[model samples]
Target: MADLVFTVFTSLDSYIEKPGGVFAPPPWSDEVGEAWSNAALARAQHLIYGRVNFEFNKGFWSAAETDPNSIAAGIDYAPKMNALPKTVMSRTLTGDPGWNGRIAGPDIAAEVARLKRDVTGGDIFAFSGAGAAETLFGADLVDEFWLMITPQLFGDGKPLFREGRPESTMRLVECRPLDVGSVILRYRRASEG
Candidate 1:
């Protein structure tokens, strides 16, 4: 069985959104790209996302794969990301996602559990935020959380953790600060401690 890992990028204030409607920080850097790529490659067997995030990433990274002038790490990362098997959880998206991906049904939790059982290697990683993150968290299916805390903060933005979900506990696995001001905090379900 595979573990389900939810990896998210957040601002210092715990917001997952930027000044614009983007999720990742603007003016991407090689350092950030390298960190993200390394982390993703370390244990990800399947990449999962919500429909909206799936489309956005498909457009951006697909273009990055062909952009000769793109950052070195980003250029390298794009192909790896694009080639990875993906599952987009959406009810409305029809047919193919134009990438190596398929649309998952409405039952996010059950689908995630099925993926966990089906995988033969590595972990099932969801680079998630907002609705997708909330669904997985509320379902109590996330085995681990890997959060990257950027140095900046947004006064008002989409929060990583929302209200209404029952309170849960986590066991700290690791805390590492990157060369940049960004920090990575890793945790697992408290029951696994």
Candidate 2:
């Protein structure tokens, strides 16, 4: 079965977004993190996202591909991101979600489980959406977590690990520091370890 890897980019305090719903790259974000992300994306057979993140990413990356002046236009992973098949978990979004994507059914957990059982060769990567991640976490469907933790703190914001998730031990698979002072941590469910 394909492993479901939830990848998150957060502040040291674990907040994924700043207050007021601002979504910006961490101050310490650099090429090292980008390279690491590219490698992970390269290994993903399918990309998954929550509705908000999916829409934001599609708008940015799709525009980048066509806009030569776009900051992300030259990024190595831009094309791969656009080309990869994506499943957006959403109940309100209808029709095509663009950029080689589809809207998932109402049952999010079941759809994710089906992907884990059917997809082969590479793993499924969840790039964003804490709510979706929490749902997957609660259902015991997430196999791994790849977190990029920056040094700064948001004080208060949208946390990646929210309340009500089932308590489970995580095995530290890898830890590496980037030149920009950000740290990359990989963890697997201890039960699987």
Off by over 4 Å in 1: 19-31, 64-74
Query: Which window of ten consecutive residues has the lowest lDDT sum in model 2?
Result: 26-35
Model 1 per-residue lDDT at 172: 91
Q: Tell me each candidate's TM-score.
A: 0.88, 0.92
**Per-residue alpha-carbon lDDT of model 1 for 41-89, expressed as tens digits?**
7688899988888987887777765776655334655667777889997
Residue-level error in angstroms, candidate 2, position 111: 0.4
Per-residue lDDT tens digits for candidate 2, residues 84-120, read 8899888788999788999989887889989989889
List per-prediction Cα lDDT, in the order shown. 0.80, 0.84
